[model samples]
Target: MSRRSTRAARPAGAARPAGCPCGLPEPYDACCGRFHAGAAAPTAEALMRSRYSAFVQANAAYLLRTWHPRTRPDRLDLGPGTRWTGLEILAVRDGSAFHTTGTVTFRASFRGGSLHERSRFERVDGAWAYLDGEFPD
Candidate 1:
């Protein structure tokens, strides 16, 4: 089976709660949902948060689409049992609406553990795209 299929299935068209999975105070529709529906994220931090939400929802298409094409993987597998729990934005640098490049450091908690990484983003075609990340020691 495809790794994507191994993930827990969410009910199709299920109504999501007002709060977004990315730990943002705003509703899903007002936050990451708009990004998933084709609106470009205004800043790198917004893209990072929305990417976290996509992972939580197992939305691989959104993940791939938002990834920088040059570094994007041939395919993605949301491997089984990795339940994303929460996100905490630690810092952001340069990646504003006017900046072409930026970085976001965040802590993302999951069922088994948490990941702390500084992710890099760049604007491609006037939209923010995830480039890569580094795990802090």
Candidate 2:
């Protein structure tokens, strides 16, 4: 006999989650949504997570706003068909509130493949901003 437990039926009053695309246990609104709404991310990892969520939500304005002005592009094109699937934070360094600069190493998976980037971040105007990145082999 199989020991697998069957699923329990939910009450009609129960709300279902579409799930936060950022891979966090919390819902989108509680997690990355605050950052998209203009709240500054407290850490470099937080900014990186919110940035990943932004890509998933296609909030180009938020992405642009969090990017450093010196390195920010003139325009952003998210493309038509690329779908981001998941985000995995690999490493972090010096990105705390006490530091003015930091880096986050992460893997962002998509429909076809994944992007591995060591993204640099710096404080601009007292807020953390994406500065640039390097692709490591």
Candidate 3:
């Protein structure tokens, strides 16, 4: 495969921590990469966190495709100075429908500083995807 296709076939393998927030029962590459590479994610929260990681790593294509159409943005400009500190999965439940959602509360740090939010997700066509989120002070 040519360099371009190889890059497209396999998204750059950034230094993902030993395990991923997805809880997909494997490392980020083996787990989420499967989904990022066209396979399916196991649950809503998994897909959401993986998308978060994708953003942190600057994977634009993955971010857009996984975004729900109703709320999907025309473009994803993640910008600069945004560093992900850590992830704490608060809870995941009630994912039995296309609109069924779940929440993942996590602490993220960046140049602007740090904040915590409960990100939301929804499943569509047997694939879980990120929607939007809410931040609480």
Candidate 4:
């Protein structure tokens, strides 16, 4: 990713307390840092936003860095006309053994078009991180 994209991605949204903007009652680090940290995300939602940031910032290191070894891709593409607008937390639940999960819904604008998605997250090593999530339109 380009430095411009990386720098642009980090500053678009308000600095959240590592918590779910969806009001899921969790901190960002506790909810999403695990996958961001190379562990497993406790849910699918957390994985989504962090991935979004990864794309916006063109954070190839972070993208490759956080991907699960089983399914990690060789490289990521930060497509043209991508911009982040805001984030919102949706729901959360406890997973098995020091693992928690959450679902987050968010809106973003790219190429002058708006998009929405529900992201998931997971917890690992007593911390949360993004796992993998699907874009549900």
Candidate 5:
């Protein structure tokens, strides 16, 4: 069997906590929540943060929507037992209002360990979408 690391989905109308899972100082409603609620992220970093928040919440729809069409999978399967703990952005390249493409390196921690990747992003229809990533050696 092939193991897949995909995003999950949050339950309907769940009460938000004091802060965003993205680790931003702002509250959930003010930070990544806005992106989850339909607002477009302004930069690649913003999109990356929001995506991390989505993973933490198991919001598969949001993750898929922000994925580049060329790379998006037909379905997501976030490990049912996985528990996301936090996110930390390590680096970034271009990906902004002025740039069509950009890259963000980050580490996403969970119960046991963490995932590290340098993700790529590009604009599609004027909105940033996740393209792909590479694991550093």
Candidate 6:
């Protein structure tokens, strides 16, 4: 089996005592937690941040829900042993509340390494959703 297939889902409802895993200054409940609890993100960037937090928390349901239907994968496997450590938003463009499309460039650091990606988002049915992403060379 591939590494992705070998991955297992973390237990749902795991408690987070610290701030959100997305590197936001606010506590989880005030930040990404609200989004996880059915509250809509106000902007594409906010959705992007919450999605990052979802990955950190192994919240696969939230990830699938926030992904644009056209491009959303059938399954998301957050391959095991990966520990997301930090996030840095490098830039954002046109993902405002009034805009339909936007992009966010960020660096996500993990245990063994880091990845730099420029992600695209779009508003679907008046809610922001992840569309796609490109890795920087």
lDDT of 5 by residue, 27-128 (tens): 989999999999999999999999999988899999999999999999999988999997878787888799999999888899999999989999999999
lDDT of each: 0.88, 0.86, 0.65, 0.52, 0.88, 0.86
Q: How many clashes in each structure? A: 0, 0, 0, 29, 2, 0
Off by over 4 Å in 4: 1-50, 92-100, 124-129
- Cα lDDT tens digits for candidate 1, 1-114: 001102234599975445888876688999999999999999999999999999999999999999999899999999668999888888888888789999998889998899
Location of the lowest summed lDDT over 10 successive residues in candidate 3: 1-10
Q: Name the TM-score of candidate 5.
A: 0.86
Per residue, candidate 4 scores C-alpha lDDT tens digits across 27-104 of: 545544444566554344445556665565556787776555545677777666666544444333443344465555
Per-model TM against the reference: 0.86, 0.85, 0.69, 0.48, 0.86, 0.85
Alpha carbon RMSD to native, model 5 = 9.2
Q: For model 6, how big is the CA root-mean-square deviation?
A: 10.0
TM-score, model 6 to reference: 0.85
For model 1, the superposed segments whose C-alpha errors exceed 4 Å read 1-18
Q: Which stretches of candidate 3 lie over 4 Å from their true place?
A: 1-26, 96-99
Clashing pairs in 6: none
What is candidate 2's lDDT per residue for 38-84, written digit by digit as tens? 78899888899999998988889999999999999988999668899
